[model samples]
Target: MTDTRVAVIGGGVIGLSIAYHLAEAGVETTLLERGALGSGASRATADVVRSYFAGNPVSSALAVRSLEAYRAFPVRPGTDLPLRQVGYLVLFSAPEQVAAFEADLPAQRRAGVDVRLIGVEEARERNPLLGDLPLLAAAWSPQAYVSDTAAIVTAYAEAARRSGATLLTGRPVSRIDSAAGRVFTEDGGELTAEAVICAAGAWSPALVRGAGVDLPMTAPIEQELLVTDPLPPGTPEIPCTLHAASGLLSRTRGDRLLVGMGYPGPDREAWRREVAERFAETYPGLAELDLHPAVTGLRDASPDRRAFIGHLPGPPAFLYATGFSGHGLCNAPAAGELVRDLYLDQDPGIDMTAFAVGRQRTG
Candidate 1:
């Protein structure tokens, strides 16, 4: 029997997932949160879940596994994750993106995601709004959809508690003492554990930097999914869309359409204007698009476009799981499970060499 107590810093979705899995394995765990659970990026998520990896097989594998886990979550005691399998459609305007995606198809299949390339006719039949636009081809993954991100966070936190883990809120962690396996909070309280997992998202750099680790991760403004007030009656289903060349993604929220793009540039005001100007050309059906207040978020971008989910070379207790490069939700379930394995010193049963070799490998 093991009596190791793990203290998890940052009670976001990733942290809560780790805590739940650790508790399930009978390892004592406690989670500390600066605010309520998932008040960070998790709350700001666009909620599109799919495994259509353009080229990276690691993230694709994680997305595939996480999809099944998400499907099984709501039935596992405490959850209102509201997972729906509407559809995930990726439109390729340029031939180069289509070629790249075609090359990645086999790898995506090997990673266990069954997506297929379909003509724009079928794509428009599914999402009707995409009729006669600059469309070369589209990848249609029928099983992908959006979920209530906040609900998922709540569910994970509840499941962790049900599994006999302690969760505290509104207390920020000041520093981490890796050598002594202790986490010092801003309130001057010390929490000790045999291991510590940092799932602090954008705020992760601070915690690890103090312990002499250099994370090449940056916090960028994510201008995602500005919702339209409410659509007219009989509006067609808004299939979850990823514009390949434009870096825009959107999903439907009942009578509203939530749209956003991945442009880490200046003011969101300019972005909104650009999107508004190009909205009708993209979706000519919607004669008038009235936008609502944006649900802004932040993304942790990595230099090498991958996440870190291993222990620091210098300290066994100082482990990390960040740098997801704006694809955190899609990778959460598998990433959480992998973090669980690392925390318990068990085999993750997957190749993590590339994932472990990202830019932020530090002590």
Candidate 2:
């Protein structure tokens, strides 16, 4: 049997953040990590923070709240978890796409997103690096920012530990006994708790299935990121930019340039080579870019690109907060708050009906 009152499966940012909040709320929480904390997708996150979603009110609200939390959160003495307001510039290459972005601006403004639509001349005026390209328009948001996700996870973990939470790393849970309120690890020891939260990122489905719960989640695609060698002189300290046409997001990290591209399905090997080739071919400025060894990490994607959060249908003591797709890092803080609220039988702050796991799939 477990000694703690709550057992949180997974010690990544989501799990750690939840554990920290729960522990602070005076609940006896134990976090289990298969590997070291922050070693999962959280570690590999590009740390882009923006609230310009495709007019999804819930997601836009959550992003806004999370951004505020990061800004208000005090850095842990010597850490860099505070928001770096580098802004985000989304570029459109086609006239139709520019019209779409222009349409999106009104809703984004209504959602309190500090965004502005700029033309190619203004875009070049702000960022002189757009070398005479045929850009149609750009969306600029000064509120967009980036942060060190690993450092944030570390701070949360440390804070949780200080708040009486037990963190066990390198311990993979082999099985979960929901009715018995116990978790059996691969190491042959079992821990029991009053409730269990499965926050396992990509492996969340496997864990929930182990508890006889068939959660609607899958690890379909893996994202790849490339970091260019130091930016050449004269390159302005540009904000994190996304090429809507190419589906690429590039940001400046100190001297190097961090670039990311999204591809469908799980083709890590293919993506790594393709990203390297595409980076050189598309961004001519990065033609000689030293493609820092590409890394692949899984994203827990659901049929709908939203998270599967809330109580599971089966065991009363079991809960789930997974299927964040690739937006978990940006939504971690608000998610943690929601998990804490759920555990305490309070409102989850946001109307989570749409994100409920019990919702019927349209297709």
Q: After superposition, how far is residue 146 of candidate 1 from its true place, in Å?
A: 2.3
Compared with the true structure, the alpha-carbon lDDT of candidate 1 equals 0.77
Model 2: worst 10 consecutive residues (lDDT sum): 75-84
For each candidate, C-alpha RMSD in Å? Answer: 2.9, 2.8
Per-residue CA lDDT of candidate 2, range 288-329, in tens? 767674455666777666777776433337887888777787
Estimate the lDDT of model 2: 0.76
Residue 18, model 1: lDDT of 82
The global C-alpha lDDT for each of the candidates, from Candidate 1 onward, is: 0.77, 0.76
Q: Which candidate tops TM-score?
A: 1
Per-candidate TM-scores read 0.92, 0.89
**Which 10 residues in a row give candidate 1 its minimum summed lDDT?**
354-363
- Candidate 2 stretches greater than 4 Å from native: 75-82, 99-110, 210-212, 263-273, 276-282, 312-316, 358-363
Cα lDDT tens digits for candidate 1, 3-94: 23788887777788888888877878889999888877776777778776677777888888988898887576346567677788888888
